[model samples]
Target chain A: MASRSMWRSLHYSAKRRVVSPAQYRCFSCSLRAQDQGKTDSEKMTHFGFTNVPESQKESLVGAVFSSVASSYDTMNDLMSLGIHRLWKDHFVRTLNPGSPLARRHNETEGQGWNILDIAGGTGDVAFRMLDHATNVNHDRQTRVTIADINPDMLAEGKKRSIATPYYNTGRLSFMEANAQTMPSIPDNSVDLYTVVFGIRNFTDKQAALNEAFRVLKPGGVFACMEFSKVNNDLFNAVYKRWSFSAIPLIGQVVAGDRDSYQYLVESIEKFPSQEEFRAMIHKAGFMIPGRGYEDLTGGIAAIHKGVKPLA
Target chain B: MGAVILARPGRSGVLSSLQKAATASSRTQCRQNHFHPPVQYRKQELPFRAAPTRSCRLYHSQFHPRAPTHEYTNSQTTILSAALEHIPSHGFTLEALTLGARDAGFLDVSVQLLPRGEFDLILFWLASRRGLLRAKVEENQFESLRSVSSVEAKTKLLILERLKMNQDIAHKWQDALALMSLPSNIPLSLSELHALSSDILTLAGDSAVDTAWYTNRLGVAAVYASAELVMTSQKPHADFAAIEAFVQRRFEDRTALAEKITGFKQYLGFVGSTAIGLGRSWGLKI
Candidate 1:
């Protein structure tokens, strides 16, 4: 009886709103508004009828980042519940981060290497990478340029960095940057480029790829962790319910902004599936020789990795 | 506002008559108002009060929608127009004829005509300059024949083939034009110029002809406007000598290209410097 009720709840929770194409457009516009940082232009784009301007994106993003930045590690713990950490861990594992071969061309030496993180909210990947990199070559110098178009997210990253031992080591810094027009970085300089939980937020994926490819060294590495398509029919059905029915309401209660969370749900649905995304990576000039999916409860979230050749 | 009947001093019949008279007059007035009232009339007769008009509603609603337009400089606009215009005119202007051979509908013919047409253009100019005025301009007309004759077959070639053609022609033009830039003391015939263009084009690195593979390369070329190669041997400005030596040494070392690009960037860190830096990094000799 409990299992049956659980399935029923999942179905209700993940039941799609069947958003009209018009609503989808409004949702997209609201997303664009969030990135552009416009508010009060209430001819507002609807993240689901909450009408927001393109200018409010920063503050809206800031709110989320501020709310979670301190607990970001906690939220990743609760939301994916502990799954996000494992996914990130898996991503690093696939990178072969400690291999002697990666260390040989360590042109970065004492001052270390450079990293460009796209939509890298709260500096999770940057912080995690710094932790792992230090273990690999303690004397090796490395810096992570953690950037997100969201100031709130960046602020959270900043706040969290101040408190972490990693931050005291002077290994990580935060900056506000659009995925499309990443600034202050030269071409072919970054050794590893990453985006975590942020790919679906971009308005133009190809432009983001072009920019990522632009800033990366010819043989740099690129990886991402995002919500992905679930593979098992039964689990997918349950996961869908959990996402749709409860996530927005949870947003309403927790973040006091149900609309933003609703936009999140819609965006995740619209994001390219895992295989389709692999092709995108390939198109972006990365040779994705290896790939793995966590298949978290039939694929609600996944980790993907792609690498630029080191020729 | 609805009309309100008022108490009046009169018998029931008189009251009814008065009410009827009032209704009759109001109906007539409403009819008059509906038809053609004076442009400006006194408002004393009307029982209902008027609402104030709102004018700001329209103006304050939203900002005027601006037309989205792609911004390109006049020079860029001119180049695009000139390139487009030349694509159909087989062999008139040097740039146009080359572009046309690539754009012309016949794939086989476009492929064949591109080299031949370019050769003819070079040959015709050479002959005219060398005073061999009798060798007819139309002497190599067969060069216009394409690899395929029909549009449907051309369509069947897929996007890959079209892309391949674009890359192939662009590479050919690159080499031929580079050689053409070489200070020529010897004037060759149309056939010889054609052969030389073909030979040089064939000799270029294989990756040069794959447009997909050459995204960075093409972007860099566009930045320099085809001056990248020429700039390698000759300095266009003050740092030309240093840049030439730096470029040559970097080319020899291969691995040092990244470091050299950074060096060039530092040297030329003026406004709009990224374009040049990006171009050099993409393996443009400059």
Candidate 2:
């Protein structure tokens, strides 16, 4: 209402022949642009604080991940001050991929869980789950399929996996796949679906969630660990100052890429609060456990879990 | 303010926020009627808002499509209830909680769900027993208690029945008592105690909604707490005979105290009226 009247006054003033800077942002221009938009039907989405065409966001995000692929581990350590490791560790342990109870079932005669780690480009979470399953459960039959949209990230992940005992173990595999649609991965196939710090980057979050629900077995779990809205005012202000100022500078100095880290920082702010995302999961037809999401480090990050309801 | 700061993902423009904040007086009106600009100006003016996600009351409600309003999850309840079976061997310790989680087919670390660690386990037992006590009273509220004459006698039966419910776990009750007395744990412990006493009052059909209602509940709480203390202290066995006699004597003393208070109130009322009558006769404004 306020903007409309302001525009009306600006219009009357322009009609009086007093050319103003407001004329450049005149509502008539926007109306003309809206008229043109009806012909093209271009959708827009947030790329970092800027609005870009929806179709272009994927490539823009891909470029950032490809650039940060090699130093992703180091950058994660630097950005969260190595707390991301603990968050990821807790995320995996919460699911407890290969526990003794599951091993005792022997339904498939020692055939293990079909874990799908989405946007698991650098294999940070995938490697941890495999390590946990091997060391804790001692059942080597469990397999993990790491799916990523970026080839550069997958290459970096492969290089890292060579350093661990899981290299070429046949228990680990990598595939190129978008989270929104994966024809290669069939329905009711996955036992555990994990996306850590990755769901926020998707162009269509609900579509991705629907795909997760489609791929999960009746009782499979969908777990996501992401940088969420910080709950504390003082902490959030300090974090914003650190992220908006310090992180880009660190990225510029160490990685020589301020833009990617800046995108990373803005993306965290763009992600939903812990509660909203939990509702999205619930809306996608998964049963929420407890309050649906667990806050970590004063809610700077949260773990959201949902189980596919069995009919 | 948190909601304001989180609005409009494309709020990277300089002039737009200033314009909105300066011109917009009421935020609730502004949020409901957002003025979206064209695609080109959206980045420079109003950000393209996503379809508003459904806002839910941040509390658990039956109609709300959220998790159930249970203090503990099904798995947690299973683990805790199973943990009760191991109380005789392991007491109210973490070992018992862990053993219970394992027996419930959960991972050893499943005990982490009980965030307060062992204290939550203790709270679970206390709350569940209170639930059991309610069931017991409701079951025999009329059937067995019709023979017991007065409300006092019926209330006595209820309190003694509650005390006897603790007999199976009497040996382990000492540790539960110690945990409940902790400063941090006292609030929950006291609330449980408050619930039990009130349950006894309502079950005995004491509908006194005046000051005596409070006194009655408090009286029951005192008698039960003291009697439970005595039961836990007795070695080799819980002497129900002595506990029953103790409850009987405590009720008798409570009745005497009530009579004294009532008599005092009546005497005070009589004296005040008499003084007022003398003032009226002396022509003062009584």
Candidate 3:
């Protein structure tokens, strides 16, 4: 048994190799440049501090998720003072991800029940929603399928959930998927679409939003919980100081990893503002007829909700 | 600023010493070639669960293993090389290069064992420096990496050389011993290994943007070789500190073209490598 164990360990050890950069193309950037003969929006990407071609962003983002998958949840809580949970909760509350029961008839199954949580690693949102849904109505089955790019996050969620009070019994399921190109759920099949702390990580936010639009059922709700600018100048200054200083330190302490946290901080700095993001959602044809901004401590975070018009 | 500089002299020894300590830790672990013994004494460490890789879908073992027993190959390198095989051309444009390097850095940093050891941790730090360097070279972020004076560069080089030599020597000795031959010994204690790795990781992270500035300069120059560029860009320094000084002194020379070349290389090299290498590995094309 001992020798067999050694042999098995040897077999597995050599096979583990460093993951190289993921390969992808920015067809949109290329096509736009070629067709219009203008290179303004041609192709651009960020490598830490430098910005380059759009094609490179995908793999860089992929690597970040892989490194952070394990300590991701823990860091999130620590860095944000557990505010991220509130942000996610705010998103869920705004989403109200369930079918409204019948009005006239004795019983009417709630419509618009399917939700796709893109980049819902570890099923944080899904798990929370499961509890919320169960509390809302036991009879009406609301399915929240989490789609994340990192398999480790999904697997971790699987391992953790199995031990949780709700496992396969919960209304939550997970799938590995890239936010830009999620093909598992059929078009116009989802009633609510959500991506929390995930939008800024994408190579192309526009492409992701468009994907969200394509998958949502008409009149579906789309809500995103992400780090947003805190409006007050004083608050902004304090936040920046905390983010650049204490956040990385916290990561070092808790996760035993700081670069991953550094990336998270940098990502927040690089992310588009709430208004600019709202504009993008509008561009995706989501009517921002009504919107709510939950500035969890001066724009430290904001949950933006938009709706796809039935027409 | 004065206090900071003053503090630097006192702190420098400790930083370098910490790195040496890390080297010592790895060496010790190498000597003790067995699974890390469960600590009867608990330290203030994060509880690590089984980290899943592509093949090892589920971690069945209870004890979180520290190092992969020679079985851990650079999967990213393999994936990249496989991707490279598909691409016929060896070179790419500036933008593509930058993008590729960024992606490669991300993947490289992401896949490595978490809480990496000192030597391995330097890679990401170097990558961040490369990114910042690229920004500076592009002139978009001027003043990012001022050319260090020859003296400064030389001094920096000396320290790095010392560390690298120590690492190489330690590794060579470990390899010669076939440390794995022992069945009962554990690798280095988790505390000792993590302390050194995290420090180097910070060091690398702090300097990555700057180093990248130099590497990016090399990457974007129509020239492919780093050594060749180093030979021409600044006078040869006796050590890392001297080189840093030289680069610092040249800060004023500020040729727009030089910056452009560096910037272009950083961006293009990164993109091209990732798109051609990783993309191909994943059976995709850019």
Candidate 4:
């Protein structure tokens, strides 16, 4: 009931037409708004819609993932109307592991593809990539490492992988590592680094991009598929209304968890638009090809690609 | 103004409409950042309403749109420019781009850097030639253009100057035209064409922010395209005189049509004012 009341107020606050200022600025809302100057370099970052200390965001996000880890895929299907499946499938196909596209210059020619799937905990993308490399390309040397910040999510992935042929084949690996800091991953070791529906959750998206740049070899590709700002204003309005109202309600009725789902919606809202994110990628020293992105489903989601410059 | 602002070599940060929308998006992001959103875009900030966006938008240069083909990297500049010399012999093919890669001291596989392949070579040729034409006009290097005073005649001079650039590679351009017309490449190709027309207009001092602006650019683009088509159909060096005559006639036709439209508009204005005066005489407030 408290979640329902919060949703009602948040919806009103987003509109700011029906709800009065006093009604919308609940105790925590005002605190977050005017509390900017206390931290140096403004360590305050968004946790869902409200601003929170950057130090606490990791744990807050971890809690959200942990609560929803088992039902993560199910929720994704429900929220995106199962369009995420098609997006992920298309993403892997675009990457097209084991193809000559994976080879950098000439060195990694015969060793097959070395791919790092960042924030890909569920093995959804990793499995598909391995399958494509195996069944489609007829190349058995391709390998995928799934990295995620949430252990619960990784565990869910590991559990799901038990039935697949890649379990004992040494083609799959999982790492519980944050996207912003993957210290265990050596520099320039990967040919293709992919982050699907991720990179937005990080407290500092630029840091994650820098990490991605650091890990990829020269001539290596970086691909990302994430929810992006809709190109059409009318479509964006409908998307916003649907996400804001239907998603949290669905979360509450199904998983009995509202805050996690609300956080998901607000984070998408807070994430940088496609153009802004492309600029960030450029600042991180990645060379992107034409427009840097391809809008899917009319920019409801976009796939951004960049290549590390071969100096 | 949507005019050409000359960029030094390897600094092709042209003002694309995408970048303009990016600036607008940053303002939207700024508004969305706060609970009580602050107003942006003060009317006073726009010093030159005639030029809706130019020097003013650079205040937020941090929000680079980073769109492709706008800002070529040093290596892309090197390879693409080197690739241009190979085009007359290689006819905008991958072989020329590969030879260019070798000439630029990069590996043969480095041609992969230009992912669009042969089409990228043609774009580099178009963009570099446009830049050259702008430089020629900017430095007042065109002796023919110095004789012209009005924007229309100067525009014709500039069009001929631009078309004359194809003398060396005019034979190879049919393939480039085919590549530019490909379904996938059409948007970028059309944009390059639009940029060329816009540059020619700006250089000719056509800053009328009205229907004339659109008509003038469209007229210039039409004349240039038809003239180039006529050039490609004939022998290169020998047919330039014919191409120039064709351009001159097209420009004359366009100017005549524009004059007719202006005369018609004036006639309509007279009728409109007469009706308004009649309404006033009938004691009706307009």
Top TM-score model: 2
Of the two candidates 1 and 4, the one with more favorable lDDT, higher being better, is 4
Docking class of 1: incorrect
Cα error, residue A195 of model 2, in Å, equals 1.6
| Model 3: docking quality category | incorrect
How does each model score on lDDT? 0.46, 0.68, 0.48, 0.70
Model 3: CA > 4 A from native: A1-42, A71-73, A100-112, A164-166, B1-286
A52-157: candidate 4 lDDT, tens digit per residue: 7787677656545543334345555666777777877777775656643333464444366688988777678888999998988776888999998877667767
Two-way TM-score contest, 1 vs 3, winner: 3
Note each model's CA RMSD in angstroms: 31.9, 16.8, 31.4, 13.6
Full ranking by lDDT: 4, 2, 3, 1
Off by over 4 Å in 1: A1-78, A96-111, A136-139, A168-170, A291-297, B1-286
Clashing pairs in 2: none
- Residues A23-124 of candidate 1: C-alpha lDDT, one tens digit per residue: 223345455555674444344322223445534533443333333333323222433546666666655544433222233243334245576777765666
Residue B222's lDDT in candidate 1:
33
Lowest summed lDDT over 10 consecutive residues: which window, candidate 3 chain A? A1-10
**Candidate 2 docking category?**
incorrect
DockQ of each: 0.01, 0.03, 0.01, 0.04
Q: Model 2: what is its DockQ? A: 0.03
In candidate 4, which residue ranges exceed 4 Å CA deviation? A1-43, A67-74, A89-98, A101-111, A130-142, A159-167, A288-294, B1-71, B78-122, B125-179, B182-184, B187-286
True contact recovery of candidate 2:
0.00
